[model samples]
Target: MFKLDEAKLQAVLKQLHQAIYNHERWHNDLIRTIICQQPHDHHDMAKDAHRRCRFGQWYYNDVPTEVRDHQAFLAIRTEHKHMHQLATQLLATAATKAAIAPHDYDAFANALDRLRLEIQTLSREIEESLYNHDPLTGALNRIGMLTSLRALHELVKRQVQQCCIAIMDLDHFKVINDSYGHAVGDKVLSASVRYLMDHLRPYDKVFRYGGEEFLISLPSTDLKAGHTMIERIREELGKPPLAFHGSKPIPLTVSFGLAMLDPEVNVEETIRRADKALYAAKSAGRNCSRKWDAVNSTPLA
Candidate 1:
């Protein structure tokens, strides 16, 4: 049941697409009706119609139509279209310049083609994962986590992977903001994340969990190794104070909670266990790491 046949997948995707199309058509038709019945408010009707577009909505019930995922998706397509337009113009210029002067303009044409290829490659990457990074900390955001966890679950089902998730929270982050201002707090979060990335193995992935928390996913790592890794990261992170704007250094520490994947248990359940362990770490003390379901669980220094 985990892997759907191509026909089944096609059917499901087709149904989803059809539903979106139907909703869009309905919205447009309603707008058309309003255009005839209430000509004075056609502008408002048009705006509402776009706002209700299914493809642009995060959730069905969610209003305030500025969906980040939708915007990101559109931005990717728009940029690609713009690049294509540029390439077309470049090719046309190359033709004109060839007639007008020497063939040096051919280099411009070649570069334009290469740029087109790169843009296509970027589009493919974006399709594979929505929004590659968090703008602030340069970590993978929730979108990356969602896409990666799905693929990781597939590998785990094949018994070919042992991935653990570690959730870490900045201890007393609000106090940092209250003591030094939000700008300094922001710098601390970014610096702390940089420390985590620098300390962890290159293959390990870090995603911004929320405002001052992060989720580090360690592939081919079990619970015990994950615990050790998080402790090491915590130790390294505590060694340095975040230097903000080159003025002064602000001390920072993070608490971590970890959970290993159980093939029998769902990923959400595993994450919830890690979340509980995080709560335990926070309750015990600030700067520490803990693993869920550990016997005589003690906080790591």
Candidate 2:
């Protein structure tokens, strides 16, 4: 599943390079038309000219919805549209054999420059996101996890917001790895993380804490809400056994240990509490969620 995501990022980078080349060709064509004092029959003169260009066709029709919804992509769309509108004005003037105003040409040039910047920004963002994520599962790795959790911890200390962390472990993952080959185990891990990510809210963060385990960060959530959220995901994973290569479907179940961010201690201590709760869940039969009770230093299912 994440392989597809990685491929999409690579494809987007390739397409972005092509987009620059396409725009350059279009710009050169416009320059040639101005120099020859001739108006060519080109789609660049249309009000919706951005939608007619080769790059625009790919962007509007082929790009993923998630990529299209990005801030940099949105900026690129705005700049592209604005540039085309200016180009249409310039083309109309040139067709009448009239001199093009300096300001008009400058506006088009500026828009083109801005569009290129936005494309570069989008490319950089995609690369960074891919870098931060675990190659096996698309969930974020531990690279920046501590720093992020610490920041969230400070907010909790300030009473600005509530945050919870859950440590989730796949039940008997080693059995799957031993029963099937590691390849199949890898497949299960990938599929499970993908499913978990799909069910989570956009703002929530999931980290690949270690093999067969994940850490879920639920921002602006208390212990109860975190338990509810983790429980829902736990139930979802129990059904719909994973299918592979037309063989028997492999059943999957996950146990979760939920704990609120403890303002009184370091984030690591909080993680320890969650880990203890996870241990409690495992001991009390897997496939369920348990929450840490700070007062009793115990976990409750």
Candidate 3:
């Protein structure tokens, strides 16, 4: 469900590190040129030096298209271009045996600093995304599940937003595995998670909660709205048949238990409440949804 391009992320990170190293070498070369007052005829002295360098070649020609839209990646491009512009100016002044102004050098230094910072920020973000997502489903895994839900819990506690948690289990998942073998079962799991991710809101989070269960976090949604959203998902899931193993159509269904984030309870307690409701849904029928009734400590009919 996560649209994270793992191959793209890895490739970008590798090239980014190489780019950093190349820039460091360029910096040293520039310093030597300025100090020695040498006639350096390299492209580093050109106005379009940004496009002439190794990093520039990768950025323009080889970097993955997927990562280009990130805020940090965009900032890196701007800062990199600015730094090269200043470097070119400095090189021109140094070649003439003229004194470089302190202000001019400071501007170049500031630009370089910004470029470094943006590169570092982008690397951290990519690493975090890789760590938090499940390798199989590309959904957020249990590794950072509590930390995320807890932050939302705090927001609800402060009355900043309404949030709900839903626990969904694939109906008769074991039967699918037993009937079709484990390979087809994996395909079913992956396909189902992708469907859920596609249908969910942009801000919503889906976590693979082990086996055939997934947990969805619905932000800015109250109990009633959460039910409506999940009901729609359940209905839609039934409408489409997943084609697995050379166009063999297989139908799938899910049982959901939803509960609003309660300010007074711990986040785990809220999850348990949702799980309880999920059990109620499964008991009533395998392909239905239920909401937790906090006042009565039971699933709402």
Per-residue lDDT of model 1, residues 173-248, tens digit only:
9998998889888878877887788778767888888889898889899888888878877887857566554666
Off by more than 4 A, model 3:
1-12, 40-42, 45-47, 69-72, 201-203, 238-240
Candidate 2 to native Cα RMSD, angstroms: 3.4
Better of 1 and 3 by TM-score: 3
TM-scores of the models, in the order given: 0.56, 0.83, 0.85
Q: What are the Cα lDDT values of the candidates?
A: 0.63, 0.85, 0.85
lDDT of 2: 0.85
Error of 1 at 196 (Å): 1.1
Better of 1 and 3 by lDDT: 3
Clashes of 3: 0
Q: How many angstroms is residue 194 displaced in model 1 relative to the true structure, after the best TM-score fit? A: 1.5
Give the 10-residue window scoring lowest on summed lDDT in candidate 1.
59-68
Please list the residue runs of candidate 1 whose C-alpha ends up more than 4 Å from where it truly belongs after superposition. Answer: 1-130, 244-247, 294-301
lDDT string for model 2 (1-301, tens) is: 1234777788876887787788789888888988898767578777678999887887789887778777777888888888889888888899888888999999988988888888788778777667888888888889878988999999999999999999989999999889888999988998898888888887788898999999989999999888888888889874687536357888888899989898898999999999999999999989888899998988998
Candidate 2 residue spans exceeding 4 A from truth: 1-3, 24-41, 61-75, 90-118, 244-246
**What TM-score does candidate 3 reach?**
0.85
